[model samples]
Target: MVSAREEILNKLKKAIHPEPEMPDFDAPVYHAIDKSLGQAFKENLEAVNGSVYLCKSEEELVEKLKTVLQNVPEKEVVCSENELQELLTKNGIEHQDYQERQQAIEAGITSCEFLIAHTGSVMGSSALQGARQMLVYPPQHIVIAKKDQLVDYLHTAYDKIQEKYPDQLPSQITLITGPSRTADIEKTLVMGAHGPRELHVFLY
Candidate 1:
């Protein structure tokens, strides 16, 4: 004879049904909104306590970076993009390479895969050689991107990412909107609770 526990389990198993097949998902439909993509992005970013700057040229970008460094005066900087080194040097902002990236890095400069205007999000990955850590560990994250990188929505950004690495994808991808914030502990509400406190995007 079967034991009481075995008899109960057998009855329960018979009552269970087969799992259903997953359903297919189609592209989403989005409603229209006012304001151009860049404008929307800037507005949303600022609403979340992030900063945005538009630069007409590399010179202007570097100039603005110089001003930022001047304001901080004592924080260490880490540059993740090699293309930006010349600009940093031209502007006389002392910064080390990504090798120096750490929690102590007050600012991190890097490129991105795309900027989603709908949510004011900046997305990047190892495919772009963007250190996943630099996106979080630094107190300030300064992203340098071109206007051409803007996309209307997040899905479009993912599509672009797929096209970029068709053969093999990077191990890590990150999407960031504003300064990191959390109120998990006692609902005190803290910014940069887990990631960078400041997020500044320079779009040209």
Candidate 2:
């Protein structure tokens, strides 16, 4: 008597084909249509319930950020980067220190390494100078990025990261496509189950 597992393995072994040739290093892993990378990134991210704000300048970026944080108190918003903190302070938008009151943080504003346009993902790494928790623990995650940071695909993003850090890569690299969500219990969808419930990206 032949076991079902053994029979399936034998059939698969007999049907194996020759290994295909490897692609060239410069070969494109993905083909993107002729369109703005920022637009594509915005559209894809918005499709997953994430919000994007396109700012023409730093002043406009600050203005838009103010509107987003209008309802939330300054004490609840956490910002760590010195440059961002200075910008917030200069604009009269006070924020709490990221090191303090971890549990009370309602929103977190952080910089990202790169933004992948195709998947609408933000590439973050510990090399940026903070714990990965800064991205996940907050109920609302706010990312501030530049237009130059946008890339066409994940492969290109990886290549850029490698070029940027030729010595060694960060121990942790995270690609956040959208806010955290789960549909495990009885197929009932829930947001913020494992991480932030809301994701907002401001690009200039």
Candidate 3:
């Protein structure tokens, strides 16, 4: 008998269109993975007009984020707890409770690290202390991932998870790609049907 995971994977395979070629799982897979991830993100975040930015370090990323916040009209910066607090205090951006702030942010914006990209899916995980709202509530989501984290495929992500936590996994693992969409109304396409309308990725 097939396990629940296998059954779900089979359904996912049928639901999502397959790529022309399987992603290479070799050491050089990072480049291809990055390209694929970037393409997927661009396709999902249409209003952003495929804008993507790459930064080398945390300092550089912070600087770019500040610029984005300043230059983009009415744009709010939504980040994880640590980054949020630092930015609020240092930059004097007034913020409410982290949870409430995240909820408001999720209604419009968010940021994360792309843990896995496969089948056009971007995976993100959160810790107990971390705010999951940053990942879930945003209408537009931006992710920052190191080039080294780009794996060839979903199976590679699973392997890494196993290796990293042999005994147990996290309570939740989110795999997102593209905008939340549906064609339920007589096959008419609708974006942001359930979740974020856009997904932006920044790789460095």
- Tens digits of per-residue lDDT, candidate 3, 1-204, equal 999999999999899976688666765544454466545444444333424555666667666655545533332445545654564457554444444453335323333434444354566666423436666566766565566666656778778766766788777767776667788999998877787666666656
Clashes of 2: 0
- Report how far residue 71 has shifted in candidate 1, in Å: 2.8
Candidate 2 residue 92 C-alpha distance from true site, Å: 1.3
* Cα lDDT computed for each candidate against the true fold: 0.82, 0.89, 0.57
Better model by lDDT: candidate 2 vs candidate 3: 2
Poorest stretch of ten by lDDT in candidate 2: 94-103
Better of 2 and 3 by TM-score: 2
lDDT of 2 at 178: 92
RMSD in angstroms, all models?
7.9, 5.7, 12.5
Off by over 4 Å in 2: 1-29
The residue pairs that clash in candidate 1, if any, are: none
Error of 3 at 193 (Å): 1.1
